[model samples]
Target: MEKSLLKQRLLELKYNNFQDLDVDELLPLMNAMLKYIGDTDPDLRDTLIYSSFSSLILEGRYSNENLRKLLVTSVSNDYLFYGIGRRQDDSVFKRSFSTLIIALILHVNIQKNFLSLVDMEEVADRLINYLEKEVDVRGLVDEKGWAHSIAHVADAMDELVNQKLLLESYRKKVMQTIINKMCYDDDYYLFEENERMVVPVISILRQGTNQFLLIEGIRQIAEDLREKYSSDEKSCLIYRYNFKQFLQSLYFHLEAIDLCEDIRREVKKALKVINQPYYAIT
Candidate 1:
């Protein structure tokens, strides 16, 4: 299937709200879409491939077996970890978009109960590893589209953390990984990345993560920001700014939720301290 032909077909499918399609016939089309998942063309990659995948998964168009395959492929090295170590490159589109697919699969699994505990744990582990290794923090490329690696993975983590089958240890690791990414030193997230990241934290809280673990995560963010504050380097300064925004976003999210008053208080205290000038001498 040529790219142009695929685009036209996907456009038609989208126009009809992805209904009445023969699942057997659409299999090849799905493969083609995955083939171009890394395409730099926003219309094809974002509008066509990604949107089509989301509609298909959310609409329950694919069989459980097919969804399982997608879940496997999305987390594999070819997609999730493709060109992973390289920074500020087009390769990010593949990795970032793959996370979206993984997130969608997990979202569907929440209701369908197709995935097993092992499947959930594997995804949880891979996502945390991806976050620790992912260096590209680009959100929206000027011409290509959104590379939002952190935010996309955060969405996947949000879904994963919501799964009751996932172990508490994995959940704790997810919480810690999210906090580490919030203090990412590469670049300041300007694309509401902080807010997107907040969703997983809230999910973790709602899913019954330990209050002590949550409080420790909050303190870790504060301590990381403090260390950055002590540095005069430009990168550290940017990290501080990003960390501040993340803390503020986190505080706002905490306020909206009814759970965890103690954790919310810790975040509030962290926010107050982060907001104060560095040179306060009384």
Candidate 2:
């Protein structure tokens, strides 16, 4: 297949709306590229076509004005739905989220309910797996990819939850595309540690600690201490400092009282001892 032929066709489809395109005219183009797209060298082919597809989607690829064109786009997915007899592989070489997004768009736009939860699960799992294991220690993605994995999971999960394929409660709570909170305290750090990744992970978890949990959790630690410390006159806003600081203050207050008592006792002894001897002369 000449590369320019597919490129030229995609270029035309890019500007044209997919909602209205007649599928009959679009089949030969897709049929011609089937082998290449479904290749073992997946990334090589996926990355090249996805760059154009991504640009088109962002540019109103399925807008109402292009409804006819969208029908043409559906033909490719229609082939996928009919089970194009091909070797299935779990490994993804190219733009991971791109295919999923296309499939999701096809599902929603083309109204294909036959596609089950597993299809989306595969995409979501790939996204999390890639971020957890594949992204660099720097949390950077390849320039060829988009940072839409997490966001895509949230989007697709939203659909599944609405469809009842996913439990409404099981899907991760998202706050503007980040994992927001979990109701259960049994799990923490749903993501693996990498500093760049931690910011989103931590910010999202903060919601898990409600006011009741904060007070109760602190109460448990406070009950184990030996001495209770309080000062009304000296300071108002002292922190609960180290135990050593509390112990030193306790001793200082005791020692000051002991010294005052001793001075009083000595004064009484001197007064009693000198009184009788001085009285006769006076």
Candidate 3:
């Protein structure tokens, strides 16, 4: 289908509240949407395509089998990992938007239980690997729209950790991955990337991750920032500032939530370490 025709059809579907569409009719549209999932046009990609997927999934329009197919396709190279290693390019749209779709699938699965433990584990593994390789941390491109790769993957991880079938080990791995991404040295996250990243941390904490391990993750972030503080390079300073903001934001988030006293205290201690001056007071 041509892009213009697809947009018109999607607009009509949206106008009618996405109702009364037969499965056969919707499938073709869905396939077309998937093809343009990485389109640089914000109206088509975000407003029409992603919003349509979210509405259909939340409305239970797709069957379990269909949802599984969507999940698999979203995680595939054509979508989530498309042009993964390249930085500051249009391909980030595909990868970032794919994570949002995966997140919607995971959210629905938590209630419906259509996905298996193995399925969830694969998602965790793929997401962690994606984060490790993803360098395009661009949030909102000037003309193209949002390419918030880190924030989008964080949303997927947040939903993934909430699955009852997911293993605790995977949760630990997810937490560590989040920390590593927050401390990424390539670029600073001006988007609410830190806030989105914290959602998964809260999810894992609610699932009862080992307090010691959680504290250790905090310490590791602090230690990393300390090492960077010793450097006078401009990039090192950017990393230091970004890392400190994440810790501060996390501290406040912990304060608002209950049953996180130990982790909160550790974060507080780490903040103090982060705030220490490089030179002694006169």
TM values, all candidates: 0.94, 0.34, 0.96
lDDT of 2 by residue, 2-115 (tens): 666665665565556444445464445444444344333324345545444444444443443343243233223332222322212222222233334443453453243433
Cα lDDT tens digits for candidate 3, 114-191: 998888888889999998899999898998888899899989999999998999999999888887777777788999
* Candidate 3, lDDT over the whole model: 0.87
The 10 consecutive residues of candidate 1 with the worst lDDT sum are: 273-282
Better of 1 and 2 by TM-score: 1
Rank candidates, lDDT, best first.
3, 1, 2
Which pairs of residues collide in model 1? Answer: none
Best by TM-score: 3
Local error of candidate 2 at residue 226 (angstroms): 25
Error of 2 at 272 (Å): 65
Candidate 1 yields a Cα-based lDDT of: 0.85
Cα RMSD for predicted model 3: 1.6
